[model samples]
Target: MSAPSPAQADTPRSTGFLLLFALANAGGVIGYLPLLSILLPARIDAIAGDARLDLFTITVIAGAAAASLSNIAFGWLSDRSGGRRRWVAFGLALTAAAYAAVALATTPVAIVLAIVAFQIAINALLAPFLAIMADEIPDSQKGVAGGLLAFAAPVASAFSAMLVLSPFTDTTRLLLIPAAAALCVLPMLRTKPRLLAIQTVEKTLSPPRELAIAWGSRLLIQISGAVLSLYSFYYFQSLGTRPDLAARVAQVLTIAYVLALPIAVLSGRVSDRIGRRKPFLLAAAFTAALGLTGMAATRDFGMAALCFGLFQIGSAVFLALHSAFATQLLPNPQHRGRDLGLLNLTNTLPSLLGPLLAWTLATPQDFGAVMLVLAALAICGGLVILFIRED
Candidate 1:
């Protein structure tokens, strides 16, 4: 490799600090659309009456599928656009339109359609926003950026805390998020950078077998994590903690995520310093599994809250490092978005099945088996880091 010019040296990877800030704010809004996780499920619960569980499950599947597929497709399209700005604009516009339509949705079908629209919009925005970070961010700062990205969950959760923005009366939250995301992308649209031409030096990334293993681990971890993310509010409700309790649980989970960021950043830096990835991943995963497992066994809300914090610790570590690790192991940089899309699909698509799994393992009184399964998946994902090649 030749010495880079000052201009070239100045480019921050997608995982860099500024883009990370943009993503933290933008994704914070989009991810925490108050209605989706809490109010929307409650809405389904009311509509389904006796069949609330089954009907809510359907909504989960539909939303997840829409979000997942759109994520990949939009990412691919952004690659073709040769820039992230256009796709972000398209996504924000779609989300804003969908949010506006949600107020008018009176029936289950209408609600589902509106939510699907929002899901599509979110996926579109997420794909390019994340891809840009991956493309521009250098590995040195990746962990900190990843830590910021991990903070997005808490940020979204906190943003959605305004009870005034409940599903019944407030679609204003939706309006704000999409609008913010659009505005955030506006600056990038005007002065997009030109990619420097270089010789395409072929590098063999992870072999097919290793790639398969990595994907398998990703799928399992996401499926496990999705159960909690998709249905935590419902689960808390199942435990006899009504609406207020459910909200508190959500808040606690959000706090857990917030607490994990610094820990994840520190772990990531240690990983880089030691020139190893698997060790930190392994340690974090086990900690998460223990926390998740505790959630299954604990009946006290406080204990459950502690367990949530453990989950945060593990998830933060993985989030900070996973993209960096996966990107390095991929077969080619040219197809980074597509490959990352595949990895992301594990996160988004599994929610389609997450609810069903939750339903099967936990009803009104039981949650042990389901939580255990999720914890197991977290552990498994960490182990996959061991199988990947570093050099």
Candidate 2:
């Protein structure tokens, strides 16, 4: 894959717009931190006050579920609509509106509605944004795209940490998440990318068995590595830290993200050139399992932080290769959006369930159980790959 000409690459690869687009995606994490810090606390307070489950929890779960389902639907919609810029712009607009709604919460029910709005709107942007990356970047350089996307995590961490210290109390202004996202995206909106006539996309007939193995491997590692669902920061809070646990997590995950970015870029390019996904996938799962297992067992902040880095290493490896694998597995070019959307749900589902399972298994210093479960899930996901027929 040689580089395209400047005239050919003329689709406005402006550094500011490209970086802003990347940052827009990462900004979601900042908005999401409140789920751990504020939303859960609010619900717990409501529960304690009422001696019953609050409407807030139900609203959140329901909203999340709806949002996830719509993620697939919208992804499918984007693919069917021809990967056009207009459709993606629609998604971004929806996302901005949803985030704005989230900043307007006056009641738990309202908060739930706001989040649900955000979730649906955000995915509208996420799905199409990814598809555009697939459509635009030369396959050879997808590694850079993967790295940039992965970079979003650290950038998000940096922003989320800043939010913790911010002085705004208005839902809209409390954290500058809305403002940050707006600033990042404003440039892109003003200077849009040109679209070609919807071309028939190149797609795989069936994901190669090896790539499936890779996806399977990723599924498990993600499940295992996903411990910070509902109770994570609060769990840290219960540990009697005087400062906010959410704030601490933001700091730690930010560092982990920064470390993961360059690695993701390198791994993505290597996989593209080599054209094999299994070895990296296998290494990712194994390392992730190690990281999660370490995090589950450790009490010290530094140790936990180190484990975060290790786990992120595995995740970055898998994600960097994700596009390479996706292009390998898809049996239908037409269904790429739907298939990828469903695949993404693997991440969302774990977030939805990991915390719930942790809640049930909550006990004194026994967070190790979550890691064990995560490991098993990852291992099984890897095993599933062994059965996939290669492209």
| lDDT for each residue of candidate 2 in 291-324, tens digit (9 for 90 to 100) | 7778778877778778868877777667666655
Every candidate's lDDT: 0.67, 0.60
**What TM-score, computed on C-alpha atoms, does each candidate reach?**
0.87, 0.80
Model 1 TM-score is 0.87
Q: Which candidate is the best by TM-score?
A: 1
Clashes of each: 7, 9
Name the best candidate (by lDDT). 1
lDDT of model 1 at residue 2?
21
* Per-residue C-alpha lDDT of model 1 across residues 1-391, encoded as one tens digit per residue: 1222223423444434345454544453544445566667666766677677777777778888888888888888877755665666676667777777765676778877877877887777677766755565555555556555665666666655655335634456546655555555555545444332222213334565666666776676677677777677766665665547646865876688678867876776676667677777678778878888998998877788888788878876876677556654556557666767777877776787678788788786678899998888788878876777666
RMSD of each: 3.9, 4.8
Error of 1 at 248 (Å): 1.2
